[model samples]
Target: MRGRDEESGEFFSPSRSQNRRDALEVLALGEKLVALTEAQLAKLPIPDSLLPHIRDCRRITAHIAHKRQLAYLAKQMRREDDDVLDAIRDALDEDGEAARREVAAMHRVEAWRERLLADGDAALAQLLDEYPTADRQHLRALVRGAVDERNKNKPPRQFRELYRELRELIVGGSAGTDEEDADNVED
Candidate 1:
């Protein structure tokens, strides 16, 4: 179907090389889909129709059979709408990446909370050095309450609250630094 336009002398479709490149990109996307576990695939926006093909691709362990299945998957993917393919790519790229980062940040916060509980004043001093804007008095109060709760075998309400406050301080501090680093890079 690729030919020159009668009136404008422009191509009616992509050139052969461009067509091949597009196919390869789709093939690569198919590979990504094949490599993903079922749980990861569930997070994607891929259509149900493509799922069986992907599963087949995953199930084939033999070299030639796997290769043939991969090609079939690419062919099926190419038949899908351009918008659907693009949506799948976008979803793959942004697959709870922000949420994952936040979770990692929360883990760091948890570590700091544990350190504060274990190391007491030394950890608080180190934390203050990192987050100069942190409310020292408020943090000390929360730490004391958390310690008292642990001693009395009471509910860890203050322990949870301390974690929340630590997250706000540490994650917010890191975010500001990240923006500053980006600004510096722009210069």
Candidate 2:
């Protein structure tokens, strides 16, 4: 039949081709999801039940089996809330943005470490004011060790450690110390 019926003056429902195209779009989204690493996929707003199907699809090697798995994924997606589709789309789009922000954060930490090493007490004071919870004594020791290593032409172990400590302080370390330890700190 034609797209519209003249007798009723009402538009026909979605055509079969339109329905197929929509299903294909969803399948394509499923394929994109399968391409993602498990950690990336975990960030998606999909149901927990669908995760095993997706992981199974990732493990499948044969073309026919993979195709069937993708079809299953599509079926599962259809049953999930509509918001899951939008969430997947948004997460994929934000991947680049997230990467850029991570790089910027790394650069900022590196700059702070370098400034602390070069500018000495002034930089330390500024950093302490910024990260009030940071251990001032530890930072002073690292700076001293790094300088001594530089003078003696020894391995830059302390320099590396300083970088690591700065990174922890700046990025919010999981096991970071919170004590001010001000009385024990030395100049």
Candidate 3:
């Protein structure tokens, strides 16, 4: 029975059902952690104390053994403070946001590439306007080579090179802009 103050009627502890629910939640989180690759795990804010437990859980291949090890990992994870768990969750959430930003940047690069191919100098002027540090003459040469390759039905070596150049320029520029935006927000 949960202890309660006689006058105020406030419970001092959670009931058994709540305890089981909390345990299951931790178990589910442990399963997710175990499923992640080593590189992926490095990106999260997991604690050193739970690392061994997580690794052991990951090493088990047998169904029953893995389940048992997972339960053990969950028990260990339950010992962590709520703040630690929240930090890990936030890191995981940030990974999705970071991936979305990267995809958006790639799409932006591809769109610029198509515009450059289609509109030639007009699009080049717009690109240089945004990324003033870009090499104007080099980009013009690339666009010319790409257009030549397309019309001649030759290999797309220049086309691919243009894509590589645009990806490097635009991805780097977008990262800089994101940082500037954050700094502006702070001010």
- Sort the candidates on TM-score, descending order: 3, 2, 1
Candidate closer to the true structure by lDDT (higher is better), 1 or 3: 1
Task: Residues 1-187, candidate 2: write the lDDT tens digits.
Answer: 6478789877688878987897898899899989999788776676788889889999998999999999999998888777777666666765655455556556666777777778888889988986788999999999889888988999999999998898788766422332232211222
Error of 2 at 15 (Å): 7.6
Pairs that collide in candidate 3 are none
- Note the Cα lDDT for every prediction shown: 0.86, 0.78, 0.84
Off by over 4 Å in 1: 94-187
What residue pairs are clashing in model 1?
A: none
- The C-alpha TM-scores of every prediction are 0.55, 0.64, 0.65
RMSD for all candidates, in order, please. Answer: 8.3, 7.8, 5.3
Which sections of candidate 2 miss by over 4 Å? Answer: 1-25, 37-47, 93-96, 147-157, 173-187
Compare the candidates by lDDT and give the number of the best one: 1
- Residues 72-111, candidate 1, lDDT per residue (tens digit)? 9999999999999987887777555555666667667787
Rank by lDDT (best first): 1, 3, 2
In the range 38-93, model 3's lDDT, one tens digit per residue, is: 99999888998999999998888999999999999998888999888877765666
